[model samples]
Target: MRALTVAEPGRLELQQRPDLLATGELALIAPRVVGVCGTDLDIIDGTIDPAFVSYPLVLGHEFAGTLLSPTAELAAGTRVVVEGIVPCGVCAECLRGDTNRCAVYDEFGFIRDGAAADLLQAPPHLIHALSENVSWESAALVEPAAVVWRALTRARPQAGARVLVVGDGTVALLAGILVRQFKPAQVVMLGARSDQAELATRFGIDLFTTDADAAGSGYDLVVEAAGAAAATAAALAAPTRGGVVLLLGYPGAEKVGLPVDDLVNGDITIIGSFAYTRAAWHEVVELLNSGALDLTGLVTHRFALSSFEDAVATLRHSSGARGKILLDL
Candidate 1:
């Protein structure tokens, strides 16, 4: 098997490795599409938090693949998307259905080798079968979609609510698309990159602007997905009094000054969401299977697995409209 391995910080290689065998404990999968995000860039650049990453790691977590062998319920060659978080089932958090908050923070593409390789293995319980009609591009995004879905579910935006999404990246775009299920009256996106305006509009966002002032305020729900201090500040100020602000981005140890007085006076509800729970992952898969969500068009870039270097370059410096970048196996 050929794997995109990061031997250490600032070091990455597509190395050939021994083939993996299917077992009753772990299901073997041939990854067909692997999505790369800022987190992967953080790993390659040695910018991610040390506690969550391990060296010589495989560079994939967002992916979908085909089963290599038959399981008790699922047959061989079934298309599937597996949950990346490997929660300790015995932990208090897991026992209470908070798998994402388990005491042990093990996850694929971090502590464990991920699906960036030609072959990957995951616990059968974590694997969810995909509908035959689900495109590989859309299936590869289930992980991030699940993350946003969990946050939105927790916030529970009401019907006809006004929403503002703070970011133009893939996560922000996903939030814009998923929030529509709540039947919001309007969805506005504040993005730093003007090139993303067309993509945002394609995702059904009512308005997209580079200027925060042009975005106006008084949103019933504000989603911070840019992972920047400035974006967070914008999100905090955009919401109406008593509105909900969902913080979904990771700013990597950066701290933002909060408006404590305004928060107290405005009676705003701030929700900080982590990764997706077991239930949330399942719900996202259900949405994909039932045809309620189709994000294939969000994939604007694709590179062969062997062309990972070019993929990383595009990820870092693409000047044009960019959405999800995927590695095709």
Candidate 2:
């Protein structure tokens, strides 16, 4: 079996590795499409927090795959997407349905070998079977979709609310798309890259602009998905009185100056979300299966497993509008 292995920070290669087999309650899967995002870049450059990452890891978590063998309830070749966060089911947080906050923080593509390989193994309970009609590209996006879904579920934007999404990346685009379900009066995106305007429009964004001031203020809901301190600060300032601000991005150790007076005087709600819970993952899978959400158009690039270097290069620096970059295994 061949796997894209990041031997350490700043070193990545497609190496021949031992085949992974299904053992115990684990099921074997052959990853078909894997999405790479800013997190993957952080993992490759060792810029993410040390506590959340393990070195010499496979470089994928957002992926869709097929069963290499039948499980108790599914047949071989069944399309599936698995939850990245492997929680301890016995933990207090898990008992409370807060699996994202499990005391034991084991996750795929972080501490565990992920799906960026010919074969991967995961516990059957963590796997959700996808509909046969779901495209591999769309299924591959379920993980990240679940992340955004979890944050939105927590924020609970009301109908006709004004929403502002900060960032032009995949997560931000997903946020712009998914926020529509709440029937917001309008969805505006503040992006650093002008090239993303067309793509944002396709995602149902009413406006996409590089100017922060043009984005204006007084949004009922503001989502910060750029994973930057500047974006975070903008999000905090965009919300109206009693508005909700959802922080869905991971900016690492960077800190933003808080508007303490405004937050207190305006009665704002600030929510910082982590990874998705099991329920959130299931909901996203249901949305994909039922055709309520279609994200295949977000896929803009694909490369073969052997072309891992080229994929990383494109991910690091793409001259054109980039959405989701996938590895077709």
Candidate 3:
């Protein structure tokens, strides 16, 4: 098998590795479509949390693939997607049904080997079936999609509620669909650029400027998918007096400071959401197949394992691709 490894920050190297297989509880995953995200960029640039990672770490988490070997009702050759979060099942958080907050949370690609190769290995618990309706490219969004899906769990958005989604990334784009699932009266997305706003329009989401009052007109909820401090602040300010600000983003390179006085005065409920939950993952798969979230235009670029530099550079550019950039192994 071949895999892409990050020797150090700003360095990518392709190397050969032994094939992986399902043994005991783990499952073998063959890389199909992998999405390039801001986190990957953070890892590549050495801005992510370094306490949990060492050099020569694999750099992929958002991906979909096939089963190499499995006996837990997952047939070989069946299409599948990777959940990417590997939590210690024995931990109190995992035992209590909050796997995202498990004490031994070690994210794949960040703290463990990930799906940046022709063949990858993961626990069966982190794998999910991909419906025939969801394409491999769109399936790469399973990880980030799961991020928003779980954030919505914190939100519990009611029907006819006014919602605002901050940021213009693919995760925020998917949040629009998730908000729509709650039957919100209106779902608006704030983008930093006009070109990117066009993509949001295609999804039938009202696009507004980052500083616009898209969510300021007394929104019931504000979903923060952008990890920037400014975006988080905006999410806090977007919601109504009694609304909740559900945050799904991780600020890898910066710290987020909240206004306690304003928070108390506004009577705002701030919810911090992390990785996916088991139920959220299952429901999001169905959402992809429901024809409600159109991901056709989301996948923009593809690069082979050998073209890793080109792939990373494309993601680093300001005028980046519409949604996810893929690596085919």
Candidate 4:
């Protein structure tokens, strides 16, 4: 089998490795697609905490594949989306149904061998079957899409409520679409790029200026899909008086102080939605299968395995892209 190994910080190389065989409760998959998002870039840029990373590991988590071998209710030949995170079931948080908070969380690509290879073996429970019509490339996005679903769920916008989504990436775009289901009177995306503004138009959301303006426009709800400390602050600005703002993106170590005066006087709510739950994942699948969740504009670039370096480079250079980047095996 072939794998992309992260030798250390700032190093990713394609290498030959023993084809993964089904082990313990794991199954083997004929990997077909992997999506490159900012999280992937975080690893490549060495910004993520090293405590979450193990060197010389296979480095892809946003992927989909056909099951080559299986040992449980999940069968061979099934096309599946990789869940990528295999939490220790025994954790206290897991017991509380907060597996995302698992202390010994085993996240693919970061802490373990992931699906950047031709054949990847992962826990059988992690392989989510996709309907035949869904392309592998789209299936690879289930992880990120599930996250959008969760953030919307956290916000719980009501029909006819004006909404603001602050961010300019695929996650923000997906969040804009998902919020539309609630029949928000208007959905506006606030960010720095006109490029992302074009993508928001494709997703049927109107583009707005800064986060505070989005909020000052009197939106009933605001979704803070941007993950940076600066962006998070901007997201807070997007919420109106007595409105709600959700933080959904990967913010790294960035921190922001809330407007205590607004919290008290305006009654604004700042909600943070983290990694997705299993139930949210299932809901995302249903939304995707129903044809309402189209990712047609999500792919900005597709690269061969040999061009992994180029793939990562575009992520840093192509800030203008509105959609997710894909790695074709």
lDDT of each: 0.94, 0.92, 0.79, 0.78
Give one digit per residue, the lDDT tens place, for model 2 in 213-294: 9999999999999999999999999999999999988776888999999999989999999889999999989988998888
Which candidate ranks first by lDDT, i.e. highest? 1
lDDT of 3 by residue, 243-286 (tens): 89888777655777787887898899989887787677777777
Worst 10 residues of 1 by lDDT: 249-258
Q: lDDT, candidate 2, residue 48?
A: 85
Model 4 lDDT tens row, 1-329:
78888888788889998767877877888888888888777787687778877776888988888898865777789888877678788878888867677788688888888888898878877667887667665687888888888778878888889887777777887888888778888887877676676667876986555445443556788777777787777666656778897878767666688878876787887787778877778777777777767666568789988898888888878766448788888
Write down the RMSD of candidate 1 (Cα, Å): 0.9
Against the hidden true structure, what lDDT does model 2 obtain? 0.92
Of the candidates numbered 1 and 4, which has the greater TM-score value? Answer: 1
Clashing pairs in 4: 211-238, 212-237, 215-238
Give candidate 3's error at residue 226 in angstroms: 2.4
| Winner of 3 and 4 under TM-score | 4
Clash number for candidate 1: 0
Error in Å for residue 46 of model 1: 1.8
